[model samples]
Target chain A: MELLKERIRAEGSVLPGNILKVGSFLNQQMDIALYNEMGKEFARRFSGTKISRIVTIEASGIGLACITAQYFNVPVVFAKKHRSANVSGDLLSATITSYTHQTEYTVILPKAYVRPGDSVLVIDDFLANGCALEGLVSMIVSGGATVAGAGIAIEKGFQGGGDRLRARGVRVESLAIVEALEGPEGIVFRK
Target chain B: MELLKERIRAEGSVLPGNILKVGSFLNQQMDIALYNEMGKEFARRFSGTKISRIVTIEASGIGLACITAQYFNVPVVFAKKHRSANVSGDLLSATITSYTHQTEYTVILPKAYVRPGDSVLVIDDFLANGCALEGLVSMIVSGGATVAGAGIAIEKGFQGGGDRLRARGVRVESLAIVEALEGPEGIVFRK
Candidate 1:
């Protein structure tokens, strides 16, 4: 976690409107070593939580979830942002709005993957506005699965997504939580 | 490879229009253990190539690429399918026509991560018409990087993608090449 926070401060760029750009490592181009570390941290945090499945939304979350799945010994089921030809099964779908994209999209998962009473760990790269996490939670609820908590790589703590989930009693763990950022001053994390 | 083949035969659905669905393992719902095996196999196949980076596209390929990157000890650089506020860097973009979705989408990678003359290992979940691979190849070429060939999970040999790449003298190694799939009667491989 300290490593992630430090890397974020060293490389993360702060744009207007609270957008933290981590494309250098946490995103567009990934650091597999860091991902493994994050995976181990997640495994360490949620040790013996009985995670039967790891669920994530498409694109960014897939990398972390797949890497972390090794520690959990579970299959990773990612919710598709777009309908694909291969996605044909009873699906658990939910609509979520993205503040950055300024659009709403539906995320879906195959029903066969997450069954009743399955303990699930929801993982993602960034959390803002809590819309994406809410969508994953909805799908998990729809599947009659238990939410075994969530794990994230970097979180925009100012956005209040993490707090909202915590308020709802969801155990959300973020490796690096950015409380504030200014030009050259860099990112500040919650103590 | 045998484990993957067995999984495909047992859980993969032979959908209409020659679509073989292995979503339960390879893509939508991912088996981490199987992916580790597949990734190891890819490393074995491309053992001699000095792969400096592993490049792949988003959504499905991210999972496979990240897992495969472990074997290469290189970072995974995944192309983004959707544009967002987070992605503001100079990008290498290419259009890819999806064989399954029957639609075309643009994939983008940041210019900062993939360096010039870097040896890139292109990894993806499935290879049909190879449009995605071609798109990735274009991006890598635009970046002045050399593709150390490709390591594909499954190649639909009945389709022309892998053959075309091979005919062009590209180094392509697919773990399981399916020549034909006549329902559960089983998959035929090209000798």
Candidate 2:
């Protein structure tokens, strides 16, 4: 987590609308080494949590979930943001609004993937408004699966999404949490 | 490769329109163990190749690229299918038509990621018409980067994508190549 926080501070940029851009290493251009470290950290934190599978929403979360899954020795099921022709059969879906894109999209997973009573760890790259995590959790619950917890690479702590999930008794772990960031005022980390 | 072939024969289904569904292990519900093996196989095949970075398209290709990047000891840079707020700066973009979705989408990558004269190995989940790979190759070329080769998890040989690339002197290594697949006729693999 310290490594992630440091890399974030060194490379992360503050943009308008309170946006913290870590795309240089976190999302668009990924650091596989850092991802492995984050995976090990998540595995250590979630050790003995009985995680049967790792679930995440597509695009950004897939890489983190896939890398972390190796440590958990579990499969990763990413809910597709778009319905493709290749996707068929009954699906468990939840609609979530993206604050970044300013649009609402439905994320879906096949019903057969998450079975009843299965323990699942939801993973994502960024936890901002918690809409994506909520969507994934809803799908897991809809399939009668148990939400083991959530793992995040980075969390906008000031956004209050992580706190809301924590208040709901969901175990949320973020490698790097940005406490505040607005224009040239610079970025702050949640100590 | 044998393990992958066995997984496909066992779990993969042939649907209408010659679609082979291996989402249980390859894409949707990903098997990390299998992916590790794939990473090893790709590493073995592309050994000694000068690969500075692994490039892939987002959503499905991110997992494969991330896992494979460990073997290459390089970072993974995925092209974004959609323009998001997180994406900034000038981008090298290419339009690609999806054979599955019957839609066209532009893939974009930041200009800073792929440096001039950098050797990049393209990785993907599936190679059908090779539109995604072509788009990725184009972006890499546009960035002044060199395409070391391509590592495909599965290729539809009957579609002529792999052959077309190979004919152009590109080193394409596919874990499994499906020669043919028709409804009720079963799938065939190229030896």
Candidate 3:
């Protein structure tokens, strides 16, 4: 987490609307070295959880989940935002609104991937409104899988999504929690 | 590649329109163990090239690219299919037509990631129309970067995407090339 925070302070840009753009390393362009560290941290944080699978929603989450999955030695199941002709079998689909794009889309996964009593860990790059996380959680529940926990790179704590999931008894661990942010003032994390 | 072919033959469902659904392992639900093997193979295939970065399209390609990047000891840069408040700086955007979705969408990547003289290897889950690869190649070329080669998990030989790219002098190593596939007759590969 210290390394991630340092990387964020070094390369992250603060934009209007309290947005933290990490495209240089985290989202658009990924730093695999950093990703591997994050993965090890997640593994340490969620050790002995017996994660059967890692769930995420595309497109940013795929990279993180895949890399982190190596530490867990598990598979990754991502919910697709769009329909694919190749996808068959019973599926668990949930609709979620993208706070970034400001549009509603469905996230889908095959039922065969996550079965009853599977322990699933959700991972993503960022968690703001938590709509994407919500959709993934719903899909996991539909498949009768238990959410081992959720690992996020950055969390906008002011948005209250992380807290809400914790209140529901879901284990949510975020590397850096930004309690607040402002133009030129940079970021403030919850103590 | 034999492992990939066996998995596909066992789990991949043959749908209408020559679609091979390997979502249970390749895209939607990813097998990290298998992915790591694929990564090792990609590393072996491109061992001679000096790959500075791994470039891939959004959504599904992110996972394979990131996992494969570890073997190459380089960073992974995935193009974004959707816009966001987080995406800033000048971008290189390419419009791609998705035959599966039957629509056109633009993929964007920050200009800073792929700079002049950078050697990028494009990786993706599948190769059908070659449009996605073309988009990434275009962005890399626009940034004055050199494309060392391409790695694809599965290439539909009938669709001609892989052949077309190879015709352009791009070194493409497809783990499994489906020379022909038919219902009941099963898939035949080009050895």
DockQ of all predictions against the true structure, Cα-based: 0.85, 0.88, 0.82
Tens-digit lDDT string for candidate 1 (B91-150):
889998988888888888888778897999999888999899988888998999998999
TM-score, structure 1 vs. true: 0.97
lDDT of 3 by residue, A1-26 (tens): 89998888888877877778888889
Cα lDDT of model 2 by residue, B1-191, tens digit: 88998999999988777788989999999999899899999999999889999999988999989998999999999999988887889899999999888889998999899999899999999999988898888899999999999999999999888889889888899999998888345878899
Task: Tell me the TM-score of chain B in each candidate.
Answer: 0.94, 0.97, 0.97
A1-191: candidate 2 lDDT, tens digit per residue: 89998998899987778778888899989999999999999999998889999999888999999999999889999999978888899999999999888899988899999999899999999999898898888899989999999999989998999999899888899888888887355777888
Please report, in order, the local distance difference test score of every candidate based on alpha carbons. Answer: 0.88, 0.91, 0.88
Model 3 scores a C-alpha lDDT of 0.88
Better of 1 and 2 by lDDT: 2
Candidate 2 local Cα displacement, residue A107, angstroms: 0.7
CA error at residue A77 for candidate 1, angstroms: 0.5
Of candidate 3 chain B, the 10-residue stretch with the lowest lDDT total is B179-188
As a TM-score, model 3 comes out at 0.97
- Order of the predicted models by DockQ, top scorer first: 2, 1, 3
The interface RMSD for candidate 1 is: 1.0
lDDT of 1 by residue, A79-113 (tens): 98877777786888999999778899988888999
lDDT of 3 by residue, B59-98 (tens): 8888999999999999899888866777877899899988
